[model samples]
Target: MKLVWTQIKNFRSIKDSGKIYFNPNLTILAGKNESGKSNILKALECFSLDKFNKDTDFPIDYIEEEYPEVIVHYQLEEDIVIDLCDTLKINKENAHKISGVTVTRTSEFLESIEVDIFKDTLEYVIDAVGEAIKVINRELKRTFKLDINSKSSYLLSDLIEKIDSYLLTIKEFFNEEQSNKLNSIIEEVVSHLEMLNGFSDYISDKKFKATIPNFIYFSSFEDIIPDSISSNEEITPIVNRFFKVVNQNPKLLFDESNPQRRRLLSDKISAGISGDFMDYYSQDSVSLKINLDGDDLNFFVYGTDTQKPFQPRQRSQGLQWFLSFYLTLQAEMKTGSVLLIDEPGLYLHASAQEDLLGMLNNLSDKSPIVISTHSHWLMDPNRLERIRLVLKVNDQTQVENKIHKGADAYTMKPIFSAIGLGLNNDISTFGERLILVEGYSDYYYLEAMRYYFQEILGIKIKKFKIYPCLGSAQIINVLTLLVDSETEYFILLDNDKAGRQTEKKLKAECGIDENKILFTPVKSKNTSVIEDMFSQKDFSEIILDSLDTNKFDKVLVSKKFNERMHNNEITILSDETVSNFKEILDVVATPKFSHREN
Candidate 1:
């Protein structure tokens, strides 16, 4: 069983976060501080078995008589479904039609993980009863046929009762062998109905809970442990994580009397941790050491400067952060549980953050991570699908994953950072096929369009990269780089006066080929700009979200449209929109190889 989707409602900072689809590996929640990024992690933690704190969780803004709920959907594998059916003794007919399992955890003083596996059972039972009735009618044409095609109850008990009544009149006609067959089928169906009569308490709540994943939330920054702590002090989660490493065996870890035994146990754990740390951290000279005293547990970092070790504080914060982050997760993480980390990239430089990212990728296979961060170094420039933009709009937390050309400051800066615009060297580094759009807005729309064609339309578009330039005037400046690199490229521009002027300049003055210059809405009438391709209603609505009183600043509209697409709230429903995008897609999808490098 794997957690596939989730939504949190009536929770802190979020009236409703909408449905957030996981990336199958990890979900990166990116935004600036106080954007309610951490609140997302907290809300998900509520999914942990029988856990809730009303006083702390209930938001002051929400006064409605409703439970703060977290609805989780899990995809149960065929093997898991088969096991569940066998354990629950469900009818084979019902079990065969199994679908995803949904678990809704709600807090209204009494908290519970309410599992809904009944959909599969109900769906199958209805159709199975209908089909069985047809068989019964065909089996016995002499007696009154069961006209139960319109039967709504679909209950196996109801079907058994009707079958028994029909059998009473037909048993005299059946031989002993035929009578036994009918009797056996009726007896089996009747037993299954009674077994599941009262929602299958016999299935066991524990058994159901077993399939629902338990969420384990860990924050490296918040839970970073002190260097030394008394044995009597309350065990912080970090310390508990340490205890977990030794399998909670405190004897050897705190045995001050036998120095050799304590040092021996500490060395073994330290060596294991240091080995794994080196795998990601790449600091060969550094080593990890632990000191077990009867009064306190001490952590030390060994460096080449001296044989004697120094405290973790003496090392860089990045090193300390990684140590705590690594130990805690390695000890606590279990197979099937999702890991929630808040700003795992904190205190790390670019290289170290990337090292942490590699560690996270490995851990993702074991326990998928949902990380909240404002850092760009930790982000993968390639997988924009992993990012969920957490923003506070009207003070309510909103999570989004898509954007369009009309998006303003609300999307531009973060997306640029998420895509590593600053971190990346240049567009020239990309592969052969490149599309140079006039500006940021053009780039956004084309990217969104490319995604629509590939994902929704199931059309395998070209592996092309879209780069933006400073409008028609800067086309030569960008084209110069493409020519020098010998990268095949095309100029995508508007059908306006300025674009037409630039197109002539490129062909006549720069010796550029006409075929290499593609125009948006190229085939559409009365469409000058790429924005003109979309229906007026869609273009205006997307621009409206920019919250810009001035026309140019309304960037929110495009972002909203992209978000809706990512959220699956909307798609290319408009015939005009599809026609307009398809017009552009037809050009971009095709290879334009004939380019005069000048």
Candidate 2:
């Protein structure tokens, strides 16, 4: 089953968060602090757990009047219907009727109803009535001139009326038994029709909480281990469950005669944790030691070089968090649990966060993971469909699946930062000059050249920031936000059709001076992009080093420039390319060039 969408209303800061759809594997709820991202996750938790306290969980603004409600819409896999049928004790006919359902929650009750329960029965009645009409038409061909040969030829309402009217007229011609059968058929059809029409009355919530999938919420790993060895009271529910799974009997740890059993159990659990840690951290031979001393469970880790084991708390926060999280999930999570993680990599470095992303992706194959995060590194830019932007509008929280084009710069700042442009007002003003590039590759190439020029020639260029616009079209949007009175802006566009159109819009539509729009110097070809500014030999060598030789193409070179730059292996540029770069820098750095039309 998949949580396809959710509708939140009057919940916390959210007055009405219009229906928000979710991605199948991963759904990222992204927003700034206090923008109600956590509130949305809590609402989902309440929906899954079916527990809502009016005084605590209810929206404070509306708590006096009435508690708010949460509605969750789900799309179940076909096989899950079989399980539902078995659990509900519904017969095959009714079981087939039990399609996907919607769950709604209020302070008083949690309700569930089948989305299309009456569809099959209604279809059956329609087909049966049409067949009867066909029989009547054939039998009374000369007597009546009704053209009800095919059900598809007429609407359901018109067909029903025609059949009813014809049946009444023919009642006198038939005997008592025949008249009764005809009446029963019409009555059955009408009854089914009534049931189909009265869908709202037929559905009600049941007490089958077992049918709802479990929601496991993990915010932190601090409580994964017990504080002392006195008792297991401080251990988290997930940890307790993990121990139960790892050890068939909890008392086995205290069995003095069965020391081998204790060692085997400890070794097994330790191996599992160690394997996962090694896989994610890419460390060589890290081992774990799980010791049950008295009523306490102690966790320790040993690196390859360490002679003694280190307590989990003594290690780095990221390592401890990752180990505890991975082990808990590996031991506790069942097949169909919906995992809700809030800020999963809060303490991890960028590289480890990336590893966490890979781990999350792997876990998603078993269960859907919905994570709330402010870290751009946590988001996969390649999967924009998995992102939902949360923003506060007029003091009401709104969750948007797609970022609105008209959203102001502040509203768009998170997404901009996720794509790697420092667009905050303070950072935007750090440089006296701004060089707008079409994409990240352009930014990287220019910055790399700027450094090269400074190093090779000792000519200190003016301090400028290269702002990548994501694309030529986005340039207009970025300009709308970043353009101010003090800053001098220059747009470097390719000499392609899109670049030309963008240039036209910048000048005519945006009132930007034509001189501010810079294009790649004309090479041999009329169509030249930023890549054409670099020498072919050096550019091809960089591409070859970054990607496979067979995949070396102009498109890939332009697209994967950021990845190549991050690799830090290709820093060489041809002398001609360096000269061309110097000339462009000289042109942009001129005092007269900075003062030309705002």
RMSD after CA superposition, every candidate: 11.6, 13.9
Question: How accurate locally, in lDDT, is each candidate?
Answer: 0.67, 0.65
Query: Residue 367 CA error for candidate 1 (Å)?
Result: 1.0
Q: Which digits, one per residue and each the tens of the lDDT, describe model 2 over residues 101-168? A: 66677666435443545445546665656655665656667434545443233433444466566556
Q: Poorest 10 consecutive residues of model 1 by lDDT?
A: 148-157
Clashing pairs in 2: none
Residue 164 lDDT in model 2?
62
Q: How far is candidate 1 from the true structure (C-alpha RMSD, Å)?
A: 11.6
Scanning candidate 2 in windows of ten residues, the lowest lDDT window is 200-209
Candidate 1 per-residue lDDT over residues 1-598, each given as its tens digit:
6667888888878888888877667788877788888988988887775465778776767687755888788776677677666766755576645547666667754333223455444444444444444445566653344454322334434544554554454556566776665665445545444544534452245765577767778876677756887777777877777667546465445645677777787888788767777787764468877777678888888877648888888888878888788876677564367788987867887778888888897777666789998776666644455677788888888877543333345444555554423324354444667777787557656666666666676666777766667578888876665556656777888988888899999998789989889776644465477777778887766534335556453233443444445544556546777787776666766752222233
Per-residue lDDT value at 229 in model 2: 40
